[model samples]
Target: MKNVDIDLNLLVALDVLLAEGSVTAAAQRLGLSISAMSRTLARLRAATGDPLLVRAGRGMVPTPRAEELREHVHILTRDAQAVLRPQMNKLDVDALDLTFTIRVSEAFMAFLSAVVVAAVSKTAPGVCLRFAPKPDKDAGPLRDGVIDLEIGVIGTTAPEIRTRFLFNDRLVGLVRTGHWLLAAGDVIRPETYAACYHIAVSKDGNTVGPIDAALHALGLERLIKVVVPGFPDAMRIARQSDLVALVPQSCVGNHQTPDHDAMSGLASFDLPVVIPDFKISAMWHPRRDADPAHKWLRDTVMDICRAAYLQR
Candidate 1:
């Protein structure tokens, strides 16, 4: 048998043909005339020495050889796209209307929503953002391109996923403005912190955390009267009662206005214990790592988060 040399366009055409399963539909997908698509399919059949697709009823089905080659075609097309995308450096953000889906926890959304929305609108008037609740640290959405980005700690990630650090976040104590803890001193001591009734926030529903460990080191433990999944809920409960909640400072934000930014009802203070700060990262599939529009969005988010952290 003789060898056949294939190019990127040929691979893309085959991929589309196999996906659409009809010469007319594939032609539509590739924006080609029916005659041009037929000729291309005829060329493909001759090059591969197989009837790449055949009629099975009123529609076409991929032949066995085509079936076997389908995945290879997809991978090659994606690789070619990734290889060539870096050459595309020009991006008209305001002219392109695209929707980016990002997954994050409730705290992250509350912390960065106002800033991200304002920046994106001011720069990319046509682009929109759709936020999905991050129920877990699953990497499936990023790998499969189901979501554009995932914002969280880089605890673990698939090798193919690309990640960039957004900021380093530390936990702080939150309480209502008139809470008794505020009246104690400028900085609440570990004993003072542990003495108050506490509201613990954990996504995994575990009541124990690093704060608890630090308190235990001092031979003391706080009374955790509540366990909840979200920082906002914890704030709500703490504000209404005498409990103090430890949460990320990033979650407490100000509503922006022309005059000044107004802080939310929740107030934050540094934790008495020395808990390590966790890193927040923006993760995406490598296939989109080099695309100009995607690159802009990623950098934009990193900038917003950095500014927010600086302000706090």
Candidate 2:
């Protein structure tokens, strides 16, 4: 067998042929005459060293080799189209209409929604933001270009994705005011903390976390009576029960209501145990790292997070 070279144009022709499964239909799709498309297919077959398409009754049938390359040809054509499309940076923000899908934690969305919406609207009125739930730190979506941005701790990010630290957050304990734990003392000691029933937020359903690691180091472990999926659920449980909740201090800031009395029911305290502070970051595919619109969006988020943390 001899090595053969293939061109992108032929790849596109092959993709259309595979999809339509007929030379005439492929020609129509590619806006070319049937003879031109047939010639292209012949070239493609020669280049690939395979009889890619063979006549089968009324329509063309893909040979085994062609069938194997069908999906790859389509993927290459789509990627090429994306690359050949007019550069986003060259378009005017006011005239550009595009949607960006962001995967973020509920806590981050609740706190940053207003700021993010305002920032984008001010410069790019035509742009739309689609907020998606980030139940796990999977980088596959980002790598495949399905997710435009990911906001959370940087632990699960892929090595190739570009990441910028948004801010650092420390775990703090929250409890309902007038709770026995608070009434009993001005400062929470490790022993007193370990004795209280706690609500744990484990989206992945894991019992151990940074807080647990810290407690282990101190020779103490809080008894988690309830394990929930999110911080909001833990807060809800903490509001009505004597159970203590360990959460990011920033996560609870946006939930503060207007009623002073209602606000007074919850109190946040620093954990007595030593734990490493986690840095939250915004991550995106490297292909979009240099895009001006994406850059602006990322910078706006970083700025808002910085300001929000400073205000707290």
Candidate 3:
């Protein structure tokens, strides 16, 4: 084929002329005068080497070549229209298929996994919720869009992230049922609580937290013998041993706890020293703040957390 340059505008005219047939109607449809349409038709004829439209009895008819090219031009015009159109505003959750990664602590997932899964599955059948373990409080995943949402305490200092309060979380002491602190006649005090071998839960694997600060105010210090990454691990370590695991109240498990030693037959008690309750929150990047599907996810998860954790 010979190389040639053709104005894309001419394709628009060709499509219109083929559809309308009469140059008068085509010109009217394109908001061009009859004389201007005639000039454009002449140019199209010279470029395509075909008088694409010719006079019939009282109007116009498409030439063989024009008819052949009609469908192709129509398709191109439709594609261009789609490309230039605004995005749809509604979220068709049932038709939407996507995998959303959420960063959360193991304890948070353990307490709320069933409700979270059920909510997403019922509303958006094709959506997959990936719950990632929180190894650090870093904002890299949220900033880069690798994590769709974060369900934990909102400690992210990045100014570009947004957070919503889900519920208030309190630290509780967890130990095996027969653990000495829970023995029938023992009256627990800060001094007695501090004397037990302690298991502290910290994401960074450090043996310190707000409980330590509270203890410091009282001129008391607990023996933190073990530091684990999350509540479940702390529970596992404390269950078989005498270590008192400090964790969120929601992380405590009942007799229904499966074979995972982390939560089996664990008993919860009020912390001996007064400590402020921490806020658990849902956080996301501002980049997705107004996205329809993302808004649905954030709203749904927030609702589920409120309904499920209000009891805690």
lDDT of 3 by residue, 56-164 (tens): 8998888999999998987796567446533558878898777788898665787777778898999899998888878777898787555889988877789888999
Better of 1 and 3 by TM-score: 1
lDDT of 2 by residue, 63-146 (tens): 999889987877888789678756664747777577788998766875677678998899889999988888778898787665
Query: What's the number of clashes in each of the models?
Result: 0, 0, 0
Show pairs that collide, candidate 2.
none
Q: Clashing residue pairs in candidate 3, if any?
A: none
Query: What lDDT does each candidate get?
Result: 0.79, 0.79, 0.80
Considering every candidate listed, which one attains the maximal lDDT?
Answer: 3
lDDT for 141 in candidate 2 is: 75
Ranking by TM-score: 2, 1, 3
- Global local distance difference test of model 3: 0.80
Compare the candidates by TM-score and give the number of the best one: 2
Give the lDDT of residue 305 in candidate 2: 83
